[model samples]
Target: MIWQGRSRRKPTGGLYRPHRKKRKYEMGRPQTETLIGERKIKLERVRGGNYKVKLVRDKYANVYVPSEGKVVRVEIKRVVENPAHVHYARRNVITKGAIIETEIGLARVTNRPSQEGLINAVLIEQK
Candidate 1:
């Protein structure tokens, strides 16, 4: 009876889940390399949950964490595509969380749409 209904089954094509164990550890690791001497931090994505990256090499993708408390210095690693996003040439940092207070502006985290190290998270300021 199980085999009969199997034919009508449909695929969701949501996440790419591998059947067997991964050759190496997947979670909490950056898919790509960061700048020569930058420290990458693990970021939390809304969907997948967590990912990792650096703060120097790709400032656009790294900094800009959810503002936990008052305004402070936050490094940016990835730049997103939205009104919150700024030009790569002129703009640099972003204020995560709290609806972006200062004119400092905001940038969206580069969802790993292209490169390897990319995750839905941003390498924001630690403080």
Candidate 2:
């Protein structure tokens, strides 16, 4: 489990008195690493009686081309850039705001792949 609460120690390294117990809202979930591969999804039961679809591996992305005025499914070739992290881009880790190369062209990811179990991107104009 991940810790989402403030530390008991102060900035000066002095112990501080506890005011309250940990709450559900302060809970943290594990990091879901979505990778480029065959399509795969994992279901997670979240708080408030809701379920979330986590994409473990995705091969296709729904790319929206402005010129076409419609969305098209394209095979993901590789990750081009990831604003989240450079390492993630090199690792081909799919995440929100990641730029990926597809059969159609380069597209910027607009959705959270791990949380939505789907990759949605908007095509970028090539120079």
- By lDDT, who's the top model here? 2
Against the reference, the lDDT scores of all candidates come to: 0.36, 0.91
Q: State candidate 1's TM-score.
A: 0.18
Q: How well is each residue in 29-116 modelled by candidate 1, as lDDT tens digits?
A: 3333233125445443533555433333333333244664333344443333334335432343322221222224453444432234
TM-score, candidate number 2: 0.86
Quote the RMSD, in angstroms, for model 1: 15.1
Model 1 residue 36 distance off true place after TM-score fit, in angstroms: 17
Per residue, candidate 2 scores C-alpha lDDT tens digits across 3-105 of 6666779999999998888787777788788999988899998888799999999899999999879999999999998988879988999889999999988
Give the poorly placed runs of model 2, Cα more than 4 Å off: 1-3, 6-15
Write down the TM-score of every candidate. Answer: 0.18, 0.86
Q: What is the lDDT of candidate 1?
A: 0.36
Determine the backbone clash count of candidate 1. Answer: 16
